[model samples]
Target: MKTIIYCWLFLFIISFNLYSIKISVGEADISLRLTDTDFTIDNYNFDPPIKETYSVEWEAIDNMTYIKFNYTGQAMGEKIARGEKRYLVLFSK
Candidate 1:
């Protein structure tokens, strides 16, 4: 019984890790975490001059997901911008 529990626990851990995606560029970080019905992306900007945060919500549709994300923290839409500016993403699962 203990061995069976340990095997199940290990498989759960591995499967959970397989669905998470993380990417980092410079001081900005983006991560996508998947759940049963939907997924959420957390965007973090850790730049020295500016620190901002954004969120992306996606819903599953058939074999794909639809996301409309935008960043609200910007320095007057200048050279340095954050997040998606009226952009849409269709992620295929």
Candidate 2:
């Protein structure tokens, strides 16, 4: 049916819109993905071959954006155990 074909086409287009950006920082390779409401970051280290994912939520208020995340992993030859951080960014335009 034409309806079934349209549904499949819509799903195919939506899947391709989701993308990620990858970058290397020091000994870690990080991938970041952003959607309408939230974003996620995946960090992978080559030396110890460890991978960790950090999921966080963001909200925009006027010209400022807020982000908060809680993560636990290894860092700088030592274990992070547990840590959390909050960030506020202001945009100028």
Candidate 3:
């Protein structure tokens, strides 16, 4: 009986840890339990006819997610922007 209960508990813990969740923003999807710290964002609405790719760094603290992003690619054969943006987003499970 004890071995059966231990097996059941192990399965429960494994199943909980294997769960995956994601948050979608526009055309981007972010993982809730992300193993990677960086992601890329692509903007399709550009006036210069070039899509811009932004490199974003993310971190989670407490119940909020912190994000910082900057333009890291060229647009229309030129640099897109020269600024960094930060955001603190609240999420709930």
TM-score of each: 0.38, 0.40, 0.44
Ranked by lDDT from best down, the candidates are 3, 2, 1
> Which lDDT values do the candidates have, in the order given?
0.36, 0.42, 0.45
Pairing residues by index, what is the TM-score of model 1?
0.38
Location of the lowest summed lDDT over 10 successive residues in candidate 2: 1-10
Give, for candidate 3, the lowest lDDT window spanning 10 residues. 1-10
Error of 2 at 45 (Å): 5.4
RMSD of each: 14.0, 14.8, 15.2
lDDT of 3 at 19: 29
User: Candidate 1 — which residues are off by over 4 angstroms?
Assistant: 1-18, 35-48, 74-93
Better of 1 and 2 by lDDT: 2
The candidate scoring highest on TM-score is 3
Name the lDDT value of residue 76 in candidate 2. Answer: 59
lDDT of 1 by residue, 1-93 (tens): 000000010111235365544434233444444443322332233343342334555556676545434444433343354455222333332
Query: Could you give candidate 2's per-residue lDDT for residues 1-93 as a string of tens digits?
Result: 000000010111225676443433334454444453333333443455333434455657886666555554554556545555556633332
For model 3, residues 12-47, the per-residue Cα lDDT tens digits are 122547523354544555443333444455555455
